[model samples]
Target: MKTLLLALLLLPIAAIGDDSRQLVKLPPAAQESLRQEMLDNLVAVNEVLTLMAEGKVKEAGEAAETKLGMAAMGKHRGKPVDARPGPHMPPAMHGIGMDGHRAVSEFAAVAKTGDRDKALALLPNLTSACVGCHFSYRTR
Candidate 1:
């Protein structure tokens, strides 16, 4: 049983694979902006995890909502200017980013309710998006 649970827990990470090389080069300013965004995301994820560890599930969810949620990003960054995909971001890649944002939103909702089991269950799935995105895209 323990083995099965552990395997399930690891499944998402395992599926991420090792393909996360940076695939595109951006202008220096864009590259630095993206790097900072990634770092901020890392901090948010770490904060949520720490809150969860401390048994503050709802608080963790709030952190996710405020830090990594789609609405939050949209609010801070403004709505995307172009409906068409950008130069480096193809339609498929953009779709992946959208999906990742949605996953983060979903995780935040689950966490907000203080459902520890469900939140724990979704953590790996949530992180898989990050792994998949990093593996699939990068800036030079």
Candidate 2:
């Protein structure tokens, strides 16, 4: 059973075949910045989930909007960022990234209204945008 579970977990990585995904060639600095941003985005999503669980809808919305939504574009620590990753990305990948940000912004709007259920329902859409981009592109 443990082996089966391990294999199930590994399946997605195996499925993300190098040949199938587009390789995004970025400057080393830009690549590292992108990696950090992605990690931060994951953490922000988790934070939002935790806030939602605590019925802190306003806080969750603020976190989402400031961390992963449109408000986050070209900014880190609420300061304007110097590294611009979009210019290095292919147009399709850039669009996917924008869509993901937009989705988060939309979810934040609903979350700010304190309609937890409505906001939660939109979570999948934002996550789907993330998943789609990860599945289709790689920066390695």
Candidate 3:
């Protein structure tokens, strides 16, 4: 009964649709590709955190660079050529994407130094790009 009431209350808002964010229109293939990349990024970040927790900071750094850093750029990760989404993104959005890659690269450098605390401190700088991009735009 309470769930039904909650759904009824939220229905109006759902009908309104969330329009505050900028929509990034892409072809269906590109959409799927970008979505997969984003999911991979999340996993990469998780591995970074988990490795750090396990006291393998250098390994974590390596994983971050390999999976999320600048070296990871231009890798459509087996997506079809038509599914490459970067060129379709708005300039600002593309810039944010690059910033995210650069952030992980910077983090990788610090993490490679084996100074766990310092590397961990830099994580927010790395993730802020992701947060900003997600908040600013939506592919849907």
Best model per lDDT: 3
Clashing residue pairs found in predicted model 3: none
Q: Which stretches of candidate 2 lie over 4 Å from their true place?
A: 1-19, 76-82
What does the lDDT read for residue 106 in candidate 1?
88
**When superposed on Cα atoms, how far off is each prediction in RMSD?**
6.8, 7.8, 9.5
- Estimate the overall C-alpha local distance difference test score of candidate 2: 0.75
Question: Which has the better lDDT: candidate 1, or candidate 3?
Answer: 3
How much lDDT does each candidate structure score? 0.67, 0.75, 0.79
Model 3 over residues 15-111: C-alpha lDDT tens digits?
4655656698998888888888889988988888899899998998999999999999998756676788987889877877787788789899999
lDDT for 97 in candidate 2 is 78
Candidate 1 lDDT score relative to the true structure = 0.67
Q: Candidate 2 or 3, higher lDDT?
A: 3
Query: TM-score of every model?
Result: 0.73, 0.80, 0.82
Deviating ranges (above 4 Å) for candidate 3: 1-18, 77-81
Output the lDDT of residue 38, model 2.
Answer: 85
